[model samples]
Target: MARDRRPPGRRGLPGLGKLFDMVDFMYLSGWQKFFERRLQRYGSTVFTTPLFTKTVVATDHKAISALFDTIPFIQDYGFGSAVPPKPLVGDVAPSVFETGVLHDNPKAFYFSLLRHRATSLPAVFEEVLREYEVRWASRGRFAWRDEIETFTMDFVLRWILELKFDTAKVRLIYNNIFTNHLWRVARFFPWTRYSRSLRYYGEFVRAIEEASSFEAIMEIARTFGISDRAYVAKQIAFLTGMNSYLGLQNLFKSIVGELSSRADIRSDLDLQLRDAAPGALFSPRVRAVDEFVMEVLRQHPPVFFIFGRAIEDVVLESASGSFDIAKGERLMGVIPFAHDDPEAFPDPASFQPERFQDDEARAKLIWPRGIQERPADTADRTCPGKDVALLLAHAFCTALVTRYQWTVVKPITWDKHRYSLNVAAPMGELEVAGFTIRDERAGRPV
Candidate 1:
């Protein structure tokens, strides 16, 4: 099959009628490979008609950096439009994706919620781990992924807003509203499904409002001398639950699956956890967890691509060559490609935690750029929950390694077909066998 080498402008592109076959093919199959191959073939710059959307995908670091730096040349393509009509995050999804403006103040307000004082995620994390230890005490060997999700969901609801419900019931409701029938319906009839999702969204918003007294949360904010509960809620919805849930769930599953398979990595992680003083499950050794988690993220980023629409026509210079991108053109910073670039990260494919061991290597690892660079959580940047997500990933992994002894019950593999947009666990019985480590000092499992 000859490739459609249309010129840069949209006018020369194939019509929907002529493009439907390609669209359907890409939408349903080989999308990740399609993007990966395109990145390889075009040397970090290529155009695709995936989902009938005209998109410019850039795998070049210079291009990605330029896209991040040039404000006028990049715009947020909010979550509502990206994954529209899906329950849990329909058109009303709260994100910079919904609001075009950077909204830095709002982003900061939301970031604060994930921090310790206000929403108490750290405390919640500790409590959940303690509860999980007790729950798995006598089981000896257990499926760790399910337990982790249950714990994470419970913590997110309890500390974030004090939402109360039966754990199983809440999980079932959330799965239905976010993952099960809603996802299937949205796939088949997007418009109707999305509209229905909005109804669920309304219920969720109401529930959140009910769970957390808006006036009281706001008063707490004011007591801290900070106002704006609405903004806080939006931020919380986006960061604390919506964004965090997808990534954390995937991260928990992926990390466990990988640890179960790779004994060396697992042993190293376990040793690090054990070295920590007893009852220090949530302490500084968590940094080791962060490093190991980063390695996993590099291998399998939950969101493989970060995108920004060009705000104005611009030229991005790269080691390979210069490319002219027009205003309104969409640029997808292909994260997997960048992460695998050997120049930035030598031997990118090998699961070597030591790759990030050196301070210099750590500095170059741009998963979350520092303040001098564009903060990964900048309101303008697409991955706003980067810090929060990393923290959660670190905490979750450390808790698992420290509190339990585990082994893979099945081989872990990434399912490219599961979600066209994000990396997900391969469908099947994805299980891990683990036992809570008994700590005699505490007279219970830790």
Candidate 2:
């Protein structure tokens, strides 16, 4: 008698039960090796596992794009809700997730926020960068992750929520939640000890609700006949959730690590800074902070993978062959693969700022795609705070590179182990040391 092969989409493997148990136990303990090995073997194809739940993984670009392009067939699965992690700093209340939008139309208010522009984006960039410079000037050898998180939180709050809070308070909030790995773990399992933190979050939200300014803002909206308090609140919550809940720390780590690795890149960046008018380092123009920031994004993309679940069956044409995707099958848009595609980008691995220097390259670069007609965030539900994330990242990177001359204390290595569900980060301390580059002509560090 021959051994039986498990049917597709079924649970449990005959002899691999212990292997499955080990995977569950070490779920958070470095799955990059496994993922990479699987991808190499499968060659950008979809693979399913027989486990407690049916999980599908895709590693191809064309298939991923086809999946994302057909929005109605593929939808954003609210993994955040299933995990129920504690809110990021300044997320005073349960987000739209608690209020029922998590399932209904998780992508609705998020996309709307991306569409609204109160002022010219350049002006907004200027204002935000100026704010970052003020914060960066006061820091001395601080943890890059801590400082960046606080700055990003404030930037998102001020711009999206139209609210203000003390910088120290912002840092305190983020530090308390982010560093508590135990709490983060509790978020994954509802019955865990740290689950009660949700009540505190609720309390915090109620307090914010009582603020006079919040009431006044609501009144202003009503006077304009906006009349939809729930909508406004949801939008605000979405912004809050985006900044606090997403891959912020990982981004800070990647940027600092990458900048520290190449001295030549740093030198060029310093020269760019010195050439700019005093206090004009954060400007949004061709010679301004935005250009340098774009380079950083190209080098170390924050979110490495974008994924969606098919709502209905769809067929995707690829170089290999056409693959039929069933409804609810998870598809991954391999961002790094697209970013490193040589056909799209010549010498993709080499960090060439000049790659984006030409109009042709800029048109082809995926980093700032969907900006003019359909913004990147609008196209998918995966990155809810895409615009805000880019804006904050640009501002933070500009301030660090321009105001402070930093060198990598240790050579920054992009360890594959740190690649989580989204962007990558250092598995351990990614340290850098910097001397201020005050005067480039003098060739002396300040």
Highest TM-score: which candidate? 1
Model 1 agreement with the true structure over 320-417: per-residue lDDT tens digits? 56666667777766666667777777888788877766665565444532211235563555455576667777776766665566555667777764
Task: Give RMSD to native, each candidate.
Answer: 5.5, 6.5
lDDT (CA) per prediction: 0.58, 0.50
Model 2 clashing residue pairs (backbone):
73-311
lDDT (10s digit) by residue, model 2, range 1-446: 13322112323566485357336433643345554554565564444443224455444445445644565354444535333344532343333333334332434544443445435444655676556645544555545555555655555556555555554543443334433457756677766544444544444345345544466556554543444555545335434644443455556666677667766666676566656643443354334345555556665665555555667766655534566666666665555655565655678778777766676656543442221123554234445555555555564565556556654455566655443322365434544344354443554555
**Cα lDDT over the full model 1:** 0.58
- Mark the 10 consecutive residues where model 1 has the least summed lDDT: 1-10
